[model samples]
Target: MSYVLCLHRWVGRQALYERYGLEPGMQIRAICTAESAQSLPEDRLASISTLESLDDATAVIAEAQRLIELHGVPHRVVALNEGDLLNAAAIRERWGVPGDPCAWIERFRDKLTMLEVAARQAAIAILPAVSAEDPQAVQRLLAEHGYPLVLKPRCGTASRGVRILRQAQDLRLLQAPHAEPMMVQAFCAAPILHVDGWWDGERIVVLTASRYVNSCADFGPDSALGSIELDADEHERAIAEQVAALLAVFAGQREIVFHLELFDDGQTLRFLEIGARVGGAEIPFLWREVRDIDLVGIAWELQTEACSRQRDHARTRSRDGRPLHGERGAWVIGRRESPLRTELGTLYWAQEALPAGVPSGVYEGARTRLRLRSFDRPALVRDVERIFEHLAQTWSASA
Candidate 1:
């Protein structure tokens, strides 16, 4: 019997059972932090085994090893935890499963190292960016890059600490050694787009490429979203090629499912950064919705490549699934000043009834998904405005 033990379940992976056909029998265990374990549904409640600390490599891996001994080493072990990628990579290697190279994963996560490696690759077009602790180095970047540069953590997801510095004061305040290491970039004037997919040791299986609409200077915080069509224009094609080439260099001798970001001017597309694992909640969920393919499932199959041919066939069948007409999008509702709640209300609205005739009302709470028909733009604006008015601003920090 084949088993897949997931290291964490918060990244929409609980849907794995329904979406990927993993029944209780196929899943040996779900290992996650105790707090995260609480978030699982009752049905998922059965197979979970909580770990005290996912941050401690020795303890987490040892717990995982113990689980493997009791439940038997799974056919695959994967991590959704950003901090646990290295651990997952090592565990996959020890268990003799196909996984991304630890060294390459490191390069992918470390923004400084990623830029350095991509600079050597002829195909990639990563902007010249720098991460520094020195005050003078920070000042030099401000002068060289000029105003309206981006400041973000070297290793971050979802545009968490990302910001645009428009002044010398902003640079000085952000440059200090406060918490996470920060990367400063010459803010390129371009529309941001996300391209997500897997690398089968050779080629990048381009999944879904979509445009991102940011509410503020950075892509993070409260932002509305829209889906753009997939077109491999010369600039976009070059961007993908550049990303593929950089993945090969960073990966060296392993396979990976990379979630990459790009900056596209109408004329050219530039590489932003790459995440070594699956992207956040919406992309993976929405991509499968659009393509009828499961990236996580492919990742698992990639781990057991003896059936590479079969897996490849499955991928072709899944990837060939027709794209949906119109578009689907995800949006986050938060204010620049407010204590944003985490729960996304309820999923009671129908997709066909949005953006046009929907009533405007504030559903107070966390972020909620409201589906809209292509022709429902007016209704969407009205409803969103109603919701916006009821929301009062409060000082708080959130993603």
Candidate 2:
């Protein structure tokens, strides 16, 4: 029997994958960390192979090959995590499966490549950047831009391994990063905004943007992260327009879910980076609970349809795959942790008012988070702040 193979991470993803992927006559299997796999419903996964981490792509692909040899070929390969995208693409390429190609994935994964591609199609303002490995390029960037520039992984997610060199001595913090490629870019002192949506191969069918309360770069060993969705009164249209232009440039053969970040001053927006996966942390949760949108399920369904099309030439042999069920909203909210404090990705408390039925103990992404929605955007923002005040007090006392 044919099955869907998913390279998954994070907790609380069991329901999303099961609902869309495990229909009658099909199976859903996964390669996930043991901690993450515990959340998976025992009955939903046909078989699961636990590993030290999904980041080890070689072991992951080997385990998948073993699974397929023992069970059957996967009709669809699914990968929702940012790190898993290329590995999933690699699997598809190996099996002659219908999915994104690895080279195409690299264009999005590699910071320099992404910037070059986006530049060809649009006049997006971007910070001057260079590969960290190139000594002369690094020297040129330092000489030109001087202090307080940014150095980040060429292909990083969730703001991991990023450095802001405010002074010369700070360069010592970057000891080489265990062989990961890095990029140095001029830093912009502006608020960072994120855009999330479904990008059909042709156009943006659905979109939403959020402004970070504290920039992801501000996140340190002791930090809190949060975001509030932009109201219609905000630059929702302008942000969407900019995102549409870039998405048009990066369109692939299959539909993709995107998470885009950029520097947004009141008058202009500068390109940061984009990921072709559902946004992490409280993003998918807020989208579902507040907007009645199932971003995760939509991602799963998009890949499934593509797989079917490839298997049967999609019946009509055309139509790249239908668009996502578009969802739009002016009010929603998410917090990655308490404003009081954090202990470097350590597990923290979820207060008594934690959203009903949402898992409570030991979730990885957030200390506490809530989903708020209203047609009254102003009222919704106030209510969000009020809750933040209360949660801050509760968490501060605990801290």
The numbered model that scores best in TM-score is 2
Model 2 over residues 157-247: C-alpha lDDT tens digits? 7677788889977777556554588888898989998888777677666667888767776654344555667765346777777777788
Q: In model 2, which residue pairs have backbone atoms overlapping below 3 Å?
A: none
Candidate 1 global CA lDDT score: 0.57
Question: Which prediction has the highest lDDT against the true structure?
Answer: 2
Question: What lDDT is obtained when candidate 2 is compared to the true structure?
Answer: 0.68
Cα lDDT tens digits, model 1, 250-308, are: 66556666677777776566778777666654555555554455665565555534235
What is each predicted model's overall lDDT from 0 to 1? 0.57, 0.68
Which segments of model 2 are wrong by more than 4 Å? 21-24, 173-177, 252-254, 306-363, 383-399
CA shift at 75, candidate 1, in angstroms? Answer: 5.9
